[model samples]
Target: MELRSMRYFVAVAEAGTVSEAVKRVHVTQPALSRQIRLLERELRVTLFDRREGRLELSAAGRGFLPVVRDVLHRADAATAAAESLAAGRLVHLTIAASPTTLTDVVAPFLATFGPQDPLPTVQESSGPEALDRLRRGADLAIVSQQPPALWSTRTLAVLPLWAYVPRDHPWAGHETVDLDELAGQPLVVLDPTFRPRQLLDQALAEGGQALADPVECGNAQVAQALAAAGRGIAVVSDDPRFDLHGLRITQPGGDHLSITLHAAWDPGHHAAASLSALAERLEIFCRTRYPHP
Candidate 1:
């Protein structure tokens, strides 16, 4: 029933064992375990099932997890809002986005803020978790996915997915390379959580093609590094790094392999108008900065 108990339950659920959960929650193993038991007894539902000394979420636990997470997020948001209000600035904002988007788009946009403008905080969130960050207190979420109904969203830009390679590579001189040809090569690609990977998966499925022995990396810089070392072409949407040349990915249908960035926010937020205006400015900035060749 207490918030601390909920925190302990979530920590145990994520860590999978009391020993590990104690390290995260900074509590003794016995205390954490007792708190979880008390929580389950109060709710009259077992939240976890112990099997082979491992703690796995029970059916009831899985159902209750989201509700608990939402509660914690709102609680955290309330704290942040109160702190911001106490500082005499109610216009503070937070943006949630992938690391690549944070570096390439949001950071640059923030650099244009003047003295009178409020500086926002940034949270590194992947494409799939962008909207969830809103519940976690982010004022804006920039991602490639379209948000559900009642959320305000705007198309920021359609950015090309690039195949990066060394300058000496055969594709270096070309402005574009077909997805089929790229798939045939041993490629370095980002993980499935990235927006570029999602788009790549869809394009490969539509073309009935599959990557051959592609090396999967979790970060764009690492993927580009592997490609630079002659590992293979790096398929990503990040800006060029490590002196690599990026070629646009083209499909057989003549359209480029690309991901459209969307700026999403809760329409009911207090700063909804400010977020919308910022999104519009970002759209204009992207259009001018990354104009089609």
Candidate 2:
């Protein structure tokens, strides 16, 4: 019903008990229960059922939680966007994209929102190449194509990496691949200085193989073009388009390279809470479209 009611409901679901939710929301258990009751009455359905003093979402509640989370998340983003607009303080979100991905993937992803809307005091940083931004206090970083975890922060979320290549590449038909199969193939990779190199190296080493003379490029668009040009195979994500003609992309058969995309924040920073909220929104945005585990 009310925004605060939804918030309280979410708290109860997360805490797994009305008493704990009361403690978390800083309200009395009776009052929290009353609000929940009101919400159920308005919706014409009960959201939770108590079992052994623990609260569990009923079937309806299970379906409802994500909607509630999405609403709360959007509210949080709206508030952050408003504050960002007022402060005009360059609340920098340094999102690192792979070179080709910058033009082909990340740029397009960011474009879903109006170019001028909320204008998120941002500095678009490319991943793999832009890992430094994270090291030097950039508020948001893309770490999926990089090592397991590039920075140690109070809050960090790592997403599984994906490899998007042309449809004609040798491995295009298979669902996955063994890392060694990529050895000796022409490899179009992020520059050696980029964070993706670490992930690449680790994946290959574990499989006892390595790329033979990798050629580096600037962004996701260029990488795919390069791969299509027969320069080498370009590794990228689903967001980046790799549909160039005359090339095929194949996921390795068994072993695969799964990069971790991380959005993190140091605990000491004053805006850590804000950054964490932003991270959650970005991740949810990525998840809704990609839906990977």
Candidate 3:
């Protein structure tokens, strides 16, 4: 049966009458009725029971509806894929990442896209939840956690968490601050939802370090503002704001504290190559944007 006929059958089945279906399908009642009859003939089964000027789905029609819907959905997807191929790039994509990653990295990387590049939609997600976004229709996910074995993943960047302070602060002239040292100072920290904060928490727990009374805030910019106002050192990975100086946070083991960003996508995606290419590009962007000493 023709796809158009299948659509008409579904429309009639859903609308419960040819007259109502005609309004939806934008065809005359006779034309729609003829299409439905043609569809039933091609299928060699009655799709609808017509009685008392009403249309109701027959047993076969009910069984066929889901199959036809699946076919139509696949057909539309194929058309989109073909169009994207013709454009020589992805036409659109959706990326999932934490709010900080979205703000500090993905948002800036997206700004470099040319006119013909795929337009990206962003969803706020964190950690393992970012990978779950793929199942929810996100084309790509950027997460700090290692993705599942089945997913195609690339390391995008390893960005340092910094101890930010106003220029006049005592530690402002220092190139780095030990986690233990930072722990002993008055602190300005973003909430645990932020990746930097999560990493910081883990590092502190590992070192058995605890902060004295610290200021907690939700926004990175606001955290920097508090630090600029001399509340404490802002411990975050966000780009320096409010003219604050940032010192690389260090562990006693002589390692800088950092968060590693990974880009992940389903291997079975139709545009898997495009997604991988985009991930590689993001990696390169991050390397340049946040160079490590």
Candidate 4:
């Protein structure tokens, strides 16, 4: 039988009378009665015992009541889930970013969302990997440089590259150092897998300069720590948290080297509204804290 007939059967079963159920279901008594009769005929069992101008559930109707209620409840739940998905309120947003970006940008951006709002899941990966995860259905990605043509992006901030030097180092006294000045220095560098490191390598190659047997780390914090210990100068993003008294940060070649942070997402994602909201909040935070000059 149709779900509609099942619902009519339930209403009549619950209300215990045809007239009462018809009023509750907003259907004519004849239509409700006809559907109930059809359901009973289809099931090949009497659903109700009619006597003394009142209706009572038969044994079979009592057995079927709970089953029909369960089906309707499950169907309603499925419909609600679909609606939630359409409204961008159901899925857990996945944001992929580099470790530095995760610490500096993504974490803070997430804090701006209300406690009641759905929290996003953070995925730390290299720049290319972050975009790759986005391509593979991640809800958002934070990366350096512009996104590919297929993805939509919002530029969050333009961050200058800085040289972290030990207090006793000769370059510590200088506010900035030329690109040539970094040549042959014992430097602490992030792993070449990182996009920032690749950009720095490209610039150094173009200028015909290179670090002298650099110390390598997977992330900037470790590189900064190594620099603080006087192992070597560290090249890192200009985050104030990484600035220590013993470690002075200097711009490289007076802002000749810098990177722009961007939030990217597939425009065709089903949760476009959620992605847009996240990007807007991140952009606002970046503008307030790291506004480009």
Residues 1-293 of candidate 3 have per-residue lDDT tens digits of: 68888778878988999999998889999999999988888889998998899998899989998888777656655765897878876898889998889999999999999987888889998777888777656789999878888999999899898899899888778999888878988899988777788888889989886666789999888999999998889998889999999999889789999988899998977789999999999999999999876
Q: Which residues of candidate 3, in runs, are more than 4 Å off?
A: 1-79, 86-88
Candidate 4 TM-score to native: 0.64
lDDT of each: 0.87, 0.61, 0.87, 0.77
At residue 161, give the lDDT of candidate 2. Answer: 38
State the displacement of the C-alpha of residue 254, model 2, in Å, after optimal TM-score superposition.
4.9
Clashes of 2: 28
Q: Which stretches of candidate 2 lie over 4 Å from their true place?
A: 1-118, 124-138, 144-166, 238-255, 266-271
In terms of TM-score, how similar is model 2 to the real structure? 0.50
Would you list the clashing residue pairs of candidate 3?
none
- Which candidate ranks first by TM-score, i.e. highest? 1
Cα lDDT, model 2, residue 81: 56
Q: State the local distance difference test value for candidate 2.
A: 0.61
